[model samples]
Structures are given as C-alpha cells and as structure tokens.
Target: MKRRDAYLKLTRHNGRAGTHGTYNPKHNDRSFNLANSEHIDPERAKGNIYWDCFYGFRSALAPQDPDDLAATFSEVERQFYESRYSNFVESQNERNAKIRHTERNRSIPDLLSSRKTCPEETIYQLGTLDEHASGEVLLAVVTEFIEEFKARFGDHVHVLDWALHLDESTPHIHERHVFDCENKHGEVAPQQEKALEALGFELPDPGKPLSRRNNRKITFDTACRKMLFEIAKRHGLELEEEAEYGNREYLEKQDFILAKQKEQLAAQQNKLDELTLKVNDMETLIDEVSAAAYDKAVEVVTDVVRTETRKEDMRMIEDTKKWVLSPERKAPQSTREYTAKHLDSVLGQVPQDHADHRCPLAGEAPEAGSPAERQGADQGKSTGFCSATAEPLAGRADPTKAICAAYRRKIRKLFSIIVRGDVY
Candidate 1:
C-alpha cells in the first residue's frame, strides 16, 4: 500500500545554538499578522477555525481561549521557563558538577558556559498537506499525532505548550518542552513541578545525525517519522520512503510482537522443567525411605525369634514340621495326637531342655518327679506329657485342639509353650 511522501523534520534551538531559529512565545504576538497565512481571512475565521492550541500536560488538557491568543503563549512560555529552571537547579545539586568549556580560555569571555541552558524547545514540521488530504483532514491527523505523543510520554515528560499553525506554508505543529539540562539565561521562571526526564523520542546532541547507522540512538526525529508513517498509512495517504532509515526501517510490527512472545514461552518452559525435576527427586526419596522402613520391620521380627529359640531346637522343629505335614507320614490319628507328638519330639531333641518355654500356671516342670513326668517316664511315650488336660490354650485355638476329656486340658497346657515359640 504505497502512499504519499511523509516527511518529518525537527529544529532544536538554545542560547548556545545561535538564536536564528530560537522560539519565543512573544514572537507570536509581535508577528501576530504572520501567525495566520494570507489564504485564511483573519476577520472571518478569528475565533472559529483560525488556530487551535493546547497547553500543559496531556492528562490535564488546558485549551487556549480563542479571544486571547497572546494570553495562551504568555502563560505556557512562563511555565515552561519556570519548570525548566527548577529542574535544572535540582540536577545541578544532585550531580554537583559544573559545565566547563575546555576549548575556551578563562580570559576569553564565555558568559553562557558557566550557567545552565535548559528549557530547550524543538520545532516540528510533519508532512505537508498532500494532494489526497484536505485542510481539515490534515489538521485532524496532526492533532491525532500530538495526542499520541502526549499519551506516550505525558506522565513522565511534560509537554508545556502545543499548537497547530494553520496559516503556515504547510500544516505543522510547534511544541516547546524542557529537559534534563541547565537554565537558559534569565528567561526561565521556576514552575512548581518539573518533569523527571523525557521518556521516549530522545534527541541526539545538536549537530549529530538523526538516524546514524553506527550509533544506536533512537532520536526524536526517528520517532516522528515512524508516527507520521503510521498515521499516513491509516489515513491511506502516500508515503515516500527515506533512503537512510537503515535496518530498523524494514522491521515489521507483527515480527516484533511475535519475537517477544517467543521469548516468554521459552522462559516458561525452563521453569516447568525445573519443577518436574524436583518432583522426580522427591518421588525417588520417598520410595527409598519406604523400602528402608519395611526392611527394618522384618529385621526386628526375625531378631525376636532368634532370641526365643536356640539354633539346634529351631532346626529340629523345622524338620519335624516338614515331616509331620508330609503326605507320606500318615500324621497322628488326629490333631490332639499330632500336637502331643510334635511338642514331645521338639522338647526331647533340644539338649538345653525348654529354652523356648515360659508358662505361669505350670512351674519348673513340676520338680522333675511329678506324676506328669512319672507317667511319661514310665510309659516312655514323652517328657512331662500331662494327661489331666488336653484342651487348647488361649493363644492358638484356631490351629490346634485336644482330646480324652480328662487329659485334654493338661496336654494342651504342655504343648501351649511349644506352639507359642513357633510364632516368633
């Protein structure tokens, strides 16, 4: 979509930069006739479409009264100088440095070098009214651009005064703003609040190129060119490309946004990977701890069994269990006989007697001569084989039983110790 030649030029002036193009608000009043062009009749367009001016910050818009153009310039000029001087004083105190002219000798009169030269104003000439644009449309585009600039930098950087010069050779705007420099002669008055610094559109040092290939400075002229191009494109006006915009000129808006999103996605992926690794580490630690706890419990139970039974007796009991349960053994007539026989077999085999036995009701094996022992000793059937009781004891009723009504319980108590030891 090719359009017209969109041109933007900025003229910066100060006390040091020769006063030929220096801007003064009083200049408008002195040359009041020249403020408006010969095309528009001043008498007819006096208060209506003659000139539209906006002063002060963009947020707090201060419209100039049509009846008094002189008053508007006077007020803004005073405030601009005042704010600029106040800011200059603060900067000087903070840095505590003096502006010295190394090239100029002390004997030579360098009057302005010692003092501040701030409250600098820049004159802007946007694209001229092209063939496609009417006077009204061109002014509207200029107004939109002014508003955009203010919104972009208004909070931090102050726009003291602004106006559209409709009577000029082409439709253009003149805005005077102060910055982080020193005072300009005695012409500056201290306004209450001064801006911190210009946010965007920083102008390079005077005499430097607007768009330098080597230097990466984004200057005010460059910003204006971009703004003009965009506005022209939107208004469907023709745009003549500048030959020296360099690489930055070819950059597209969509490409910039996509690049930013790509960066964000990569950062997010890195964060997710970090979290996943932490979670995996935690899971591995938990599994190791659980395995350790289980192994510790098994070890504790095995230790208890070793303490209760000697190695020899344990070996005998294991052999007897395997033999008794074997299909070929034809295990005792019933569970009662089986219990008696198994207990007798295990107790008689251990050399130390009953290392695994502990019974409160039956004490010390009945002195080794009790009738219970006499019966087993005389019959040669078992050792201490009690015949009075055959009933199973309190602990293992589920796996064993007794018989012979009278001797069942006594038999049960004798074998009860043997059964208890097997559990551990």
Candidate 2:
C-alpha cells in the first residue's frame, strides 16, 4: 500500500495501532544486522542503531500531504483532552457563561457614562516602544487598515478604548472593541473593519469568546514584531540603524533640540509683547503732546487778536487828534482850554460816545467862532477824520497780518504731533 493511503486508512478506522509503536515491523531486525556486520562499539550500538531505526519507523508513518500537521495535531489534542478533562471543561464553560452575561447586560449608555465615544472602530493600541517609531507612518498604516476593514464588514464595530501602557516591563496597548447594537445608520462599523483588514490583521469572529482571541491578551512586548516592521515598510517610515538602537545619547540629543526650539519660541513671544507695550506708550505720549499743542495754539491766537484790537484802537485815536487839531479849527488859547475841559467832562460821563467826541491828541483850544459854529466845526472834523483813518486801518494788507501769519505757523507746528503706526 502507498504510505499516504495507509495513514489515511489508519485514521479512518479509529485504530490505535500507530499512535505509540512503529507501523513498520522489519526496521528493528535490519538495524541489528547492520550493527553486527560493522562490529560497532557497545555505547554506539545503544545510541546510533536505535535512533536510526526509530527515525525510520517515524518516516514511514509521517504524512506527506504538506498540510500543517502541527496545527492539526493541536486541534486533535485539544478535542481529545477536553473530552477527558471534565474539571477543566466545567471551569471554562462557567467563565464563558459569565462573560456572555456581562456582555448582554452592558448598555451603550452605561459605557458612554464613563468613557468618551470615538467615530471609528478597531482602534490601534500601540506600545510606547511602538510609538518610538515614526507617528506619521504608524497612523498612515493604521488608518488604511481601518478603512479596508470597514469596507469588508458593516459599520457596527466601534473602538471603545485605545491606550498605550508605557510604565510596564513591556510597553503595550490596551484596546477595546464595542459592537454597536443600534447601528442602523451603519456609519461606524463598515469603515472600521475595512481599515483593520488593510493593516493585515485577521478579522476577529464576533461569536468567539473574548478570552480565546489573540487580541485580548496582546502586550506590546509579546506583539507581532514582524507585522510592525511590515507596517513601517508600507509607509516608508523605517528608522535608521542607529535610531533603532534607542540609546541614551540619541534621547539626550532629541531632548536638547526640543528644549532649544521651545526657548526660541518663548523669546520671540516675549519680544512681541515688549513691542506691543512700547507702541501703547508711544500712542499715549502722542495724545498728551497733541492736547498741549492744541491748548498752546489757542492761547497764542487769543493774544494775537487782543494785541491787534489794541493797535487798531490806537491808530483811530491818532487820526482823531490830526483832524481836531487841524489849522481849519484854530481858536483862542483860553477858549480852547475851556472847551477841552467841558469835552473831557462829557466824555467821562458817556464812555460810549467817546468815538464821536473830539480826539484826546487835539490841542486844548476852541476855534474862533460862536458856540453853535464851534459845535458844527467839531462835528464836521470828526466825520472827515473817521472816513480817512477807517480806510487806512481796515483796508491795509499788513494790518495785524504778521500776527495772524505767526499764529497760523504755530498752529501748523502743533498739529504735526507724530502718531505711531498700528501693530498687526
């Protein structure tokens, strides 16, 4: 019979013939004859000859189908051992029942009370060592896997938790998956599964017990190192040989660089604050200067107006003196003196009529005429004097012109208060 057919027939018969002993009957006799013919030493006789015959028997019964015999053996062993081990089976059953009860009673509202909900499912829990790898690369691979996983599965899956445990013997991630029972919208589950598939992880069977799954007990130290390297390769984020060492020197250098950058940023911020304060101070100073300049300009203009008014009044008095003392009004000295005294008395009593009275600069004398004639002569002279001097004083281009021009120049200077530009 062919070796493969013989093994298959033996398996189908439920026979125990080949489980312990060799299937081949002639192998022992053949080895004994070879040892006798070679005159082998006794110690060698007990070792080499026995081992060769044992291996020969094993080879004859070994399956040649190229299937995973180790996996098949493990399954068969589990089934056989579980059937025979009643105590172990009962313990496992009790554990599974408790887990199922917990899952059924747990509500999403209860979970949300203590934990924040994330949009995506199948969160990639990474170790601190894993985070030592490039974050950009890790996130890229993880995101791609999440997308692919969602495409394959529905959107009922959600990541309930993702945490990196760094303060342990082996840095690892703790991840929790929550199946959305109320996933009518189907937005979260499908995309999450798709992303997981892209990351090359086997899809987890929801019906399986949580304790039986490989993901439940995953630790950063015991995780698939090869898979992490593959993810790095996909994203082109592999670290250099020196970086992979993770030595103290490298860590110190990184710290120094980061500290320097922080210091530089702080300095720049401080400089900006100082500049802002300076600008505010300058603005306040400008306002003060502007107020002072405005007040000074007003005072100067008021003084100019008063001085001009006084000079105009003096010129009018001088014109009146010229008109009243003219040769046309010549009179006796004694009569002029008496007329001057009466005019002064009237001018003092009625200050408002001083403008029309005889000028103070006129000689203290009355003209040679009757009382009515003197009065008519004084009235005629006053009108002529006013007409002549009014035109000269009021129409003169230079009248108080210098004072006004100076005031305008001072006003322009005051208005030139410098104001700073605005900060961005």
Winning candidate number (lDDT): 1
Please identify model 1 stretches exceeding 4 Å from their true place: 1-21, 27-70, 87-132, 181-218, 243-424
Lowest lDDT sum, 10 consecutive residues, model 1, at: 105-114
Off by over 4 Å in 2: 1-190, 193-265, 284-292, 308-424
Provide C-alpha RMSD values for all models, in order: 22.4, 28.2
Per-residue lDDT of model 1, residues 180-298, tens digit only: 32234432323212222224333355456533431222354466568756876676655555432223554554576677688899999999999999999999999899778756644
Quote each prediction's TM-score: 0.35, 0.22
The CA lDDT at 109 in model 1 is: 15
Give lDDT per model, in order.
Answer: 0.43, 0.36
lDDT of 2 by residue, 194-238 (tens): 343444445244455434333322321123333444544566543
RMSD of 2: 28.2
